[model samples]
Target: MQLIKPFRKLVVSVLLIGSSIFSVSSAIAQESSVESRILVNVDVIYPVNYLKEEFKKISSNPTQADVVQIGGQLNFSTIPDIQAIRFSRSFIYDPFANDYYNNRNVGGSDFNYSDQASTSNPFLSATFTERKGNPPLTLSFNSSGSNPPALAYNGTSCKDNDGCVLMHYGYSEEITSRNALTPSLFKTILKLRDNNGNLVSMINAMATPIVTSSSGGVTQYLIAYHEQSDPANNGVLMGVWTEIPVASGISSNSMLLQKQLKDIVQNQSQSPRLSYSNSSNSKITISNTRYFLSSTQIPLDQLSRTSLPPTDSRFMPLPNADGTISPGETTKPVIIAQTQSAKKAMTWVINNKVDVNGETYVQARYDSKTNPYSGDTSVDQTLSLLCIRKSPELTSNPIPEIAKGTTYTNSWSGGEVFAIPEVVGNSLLSEQNADNKCQEEGQKRYSLSGFRMAEFHDGIQPSGFGFYAKSTDPNLSISNVRYWVKINDQNANPWSK
Candidate 1:
């Protein structure tokens, strides 16, 4: 049995009834007040003293294992009309070296490593005993010391070091209005483990008669110590863990790692969903569609790089000051500069590409001030343009196949050509009338109004022609519509009279 002892004594005294008659009376009167104060002070002071002595014992050596453990007792009593008395015995352990290392004594003598292992345990313990005839009270204990070492490590035994293990004992008591004792008990165990699930060190502690009551008052005791194991030459280390033996009302096995992981995965899978549509083109657009796919649908990393191409060159890149248009630069002028007609000026910057699951859409507006309308201010007005990157067959079917001098008519919905008219003026009346008449004719015809017939080519070109209608008298409504046209001719005037 390795035993370490710690003994402490405290004496409190109150004088009463001296030899002189007058002096004895004065002593008795002072006794009660003085004794009461001493009792209160002692209850607080005893625990503090116990902790302080423990610290001093631990700090005196290089390691906790250096101290010896001897079971000792704490004695408490109240002196007659004077003060309270209290004392405790300390338990200590011996220390042992884990390995031999080079060292020198105080005289600077060099000592080589030795194989002789020293067996010493430095752990200490203290005991408490209550003397009869004192008030019942509660006491608490805490540990204080230099910083302890880390309990766990990822590396091998020799690579990482061990941490300190501190043990503490404390008591609590509940007293009724009648001042009777109600005792409670508690115990705690703490262990430190590494990431690999290996226990590195541990601490076991307990407290008894935690709660008690008495006529005088409530009294309690505290004991605590620190212990460190011999460093392992095998390169293993320790970590921190906690255990409560007497958790009177706590539920067992309430927290687990599997449940926590399941919650995390579920939350990530049910993230917010989004949908999109290209209303201007009557096409469905989807943004972030890749996020909706299962892992088997496609490689997760490649989804972010996917994109759709532009519908047409109507939203083509603009040359910068350096004659180079970098990606992501907007070609359209700002709203402040375009003023009341900002919508028309904004067409050039619209992204014609539709993402089936994206949150954006494409729109086109003609800038009348520029091109084709040159020198024709009265004929200038912004027009909504529709351009689609359809298959070649769709483009060929819409081309007009009539002789230049032949009169033909056609009727078609704006949806057929993906075109919607936004604005029209009286100057384009003849062109608008011809476009409407063609629609009624059940035939779509090409109109060559503002351009020379000689400029017509087999490839695509802006026909400078479209359809329009005025609202009825009651509604005062107007329908301005437009579409692309392919024309083949034999030298007849394409402009309508």
Candidate 2:
């Protein structure tokens, strides 16, 4: 198993699509709600020789793509272990509905236009050819016009003299998976398209390890892509672009096959409804959706980019120093300082997306709305606390310690952003609450993945399911517990590659 260095850094350059430059402020953020941003910093690494052979096919013509699709699928055959699986997906900005500014363009909105930078463009491969070395590139969200944002390949843009796409191309896991079993790294089947709609579908794909086990085993992986979009067209649903290939050499009666079929049926039956809305527009709820073929071609201009509903306005209550709830006490999770970690969590939380150890660690919060745990709205309040200290680290790329004899694995795919709840404190909450929370919230996001408590807890104790440590500072009780979703200053990039 060969692994290339996963992440590479790149500088950003804004794209100038037209001569008429509209001097608009970058983008205003909403403090009272959960805001999401695009994560351009995370990168994918592939062998130079591998990319070169693929590049030779479509280097001559850059703008003749017939159809372009932006998502990939997981190959279950690569993983040998026999166990359960969970798949889910999320989006920061939808390119098929409308643009972020509510302005519909001739071809597509800025979000859709920016997405082309990664796919349906040959600039990234051309940059590699020019530099002769794989220097990194950065894709930023510049919501200025109907053009894609400019990406610098190692701080340099491609000259017009060189024939290439206007922007670079990169891929990521629009749909990701997690499993408790220590299965082998998954093989992804990716489809690469260049300017003019040429296709170079990729098989046996590998990606960066976002989370690893205590033994240095990768727990989760981020499948990279050149471009991505929610499956839709002209305000109509086209369905998700995904596939699951049966691994070769596995027997028909193998547990892996049985498990795969079971998971699909179980998830399909419990799929939830997702509602999208703007200020005065009625909510557009999408339910009972289907998956699109991996080889299908989707047009860029007709692709939709709609605004996501603002994060839940309500806040969760904070526990006292003794880890007990207070009555009528609803202090939202606070962000005392604009630390990198705080920005990561708040920025990506709105989309229910994360880099695991790279961007932010986002876990689904339990459902306190539908079936209240406390059975009393007052006590069943959700709490959002931002831990300032790193000790007993709240987030790690390595999997957290699990309970003795209990096995767990997790996978992330794409779904709508639902509340990510952490079940801590005493038995006032049952273990079942945590399980139901994942189902309830996952469903609301239009997903039905299994829930594992150890994903968030540092360690479980007979006393409760949270992390507590001794601190020297006495002034750090309720004040140390910070809130983020309600703060007005916090905002994240709405689109990422």
| Per-model RMSD to reference | 38.5, 25.6
TM per candidate comes to 0.14, 0.24
TM-score of 2: 0.24
Candidate 2 stretches with Cα past 4 Å from truth are 1-59, 64-67, 77-82, 89-150, 154-197, 202-204, 207-497
lDDT of 1 at 304: 9
Q: What is the per-residue lDDT of model 1 for residues 1-497, given as tens digits with 9 covering 90 to 100?
A: 01111111112321222211111123322321211111000000112232233444434212222111111211111111112211111111111111101111111111111111111311112322222233211112222322222122221111332322222222211111111011111112222222223332222221111111112221211110111111221111111111101111112221221122222112221121111111111111111111111111111111101111111111122111011111112111101110111111112111122222322222222233222222222212433323222234434343232112122111111112223243222112222332432232222222111121111121232342221111111111122322222223321111211
- On lDDT, the leading prediction is 2
**Model 2, span 1-497: residue lDDT tens:** 11122111111212224322111111211111111111221112222233334646666333222112222222222221211111111222222222212222212211222211211221111011111132112111222323323222231212222111222122222211222121112222334454444566543322111211111122111111111111221111111111121111222233332343232112221111111111111222222222211111211111111101101111111111011112111111111111111112121111122332333333322222321111212222233322222222322222333212142112221111223433122111223333344443444343334322222222232221222222222222232131222111222111100
Cα RMSD of predicted structure 2: 25.6
Cα lDDT listed for each candidate: 0.19, 0.22
